[model samples]
Target: MAKITYIEFTGEEHVLDLEIGTSIMQGAVDNSVQGITADCGGACSCATCHVYVEPEWLNKLGDKSEMEEILLEEVCQPQANSRLSCQLKVSADLDGMIVRLPESQF
Candidate 1:
């Protein structure tokens, strides 16, 4: 398992223990984290799962796919480090990553 932290726009934080193959969106939904809506269920079609990845952990998450890139453009207040949580797969290499939600999501 990996430890992932999800911080909401209101400063609420939820730390989750995620299975290695799970998507970050799934982790949030499974743990009841409020910010990630995951409306498309990790299909890479919806942007509701947007999260701003901490700068230091950006490289560890790997590159986004073409579909994810296109969908990200539709999210509100997307940033340089913004990502779709459903697109991020948990693994040993990302043991302690941190992500923040945008206000629009809440």
Candidate 2:
């Protein structure tokens, strides 16, 4: 299992202990973490699961694919750390990952 932290724009934090191989979007939805709408259900079609990965944890996560990069461009208030939560798979190596939600998503 891996522990992930999801912090909202208003500073609300949802700390979750989730199984490996699950998407970050699933973790948030399973735990009822606010702001991760995940309208595409991990299909990578919608950008509603958008989040900003904490700078320190960026390297621990996987690199964005060509399609993810293109999808991210369509989200609101994109940032250098912005990513689609559904694209992030949980792994033992990603324990303690932290992500921030954009105001527009909440």
Q: Pick the candidate with the highest TM-score.
A: 1
Alpha-carbon error at 5 in model 2, in Å? 0.6
In candidate 1, how many Å is residue 48 off? 0.4
For candidate 1, what is the TM-score?
0.96
Q: After superposing candidate 2 on the true structure, give the runs of residues whose Cα lies further than 4 Å from its correct spot.
A: none
**Per-model C-alpha RMSD:** 1.1, 1.2
- Candidates in order, TM-scores: namely 0.96, 0.95
In terms of lDDT, the best-performing candidate is 2
- Total backbone collisions for each predicted model: 0, 0
- Residue-by-residue lDDT tens digits, candidate 1, 1-106: 9999999999999988999999999999999898888888889887999999999999887789999899888889989999999989999988989999999852
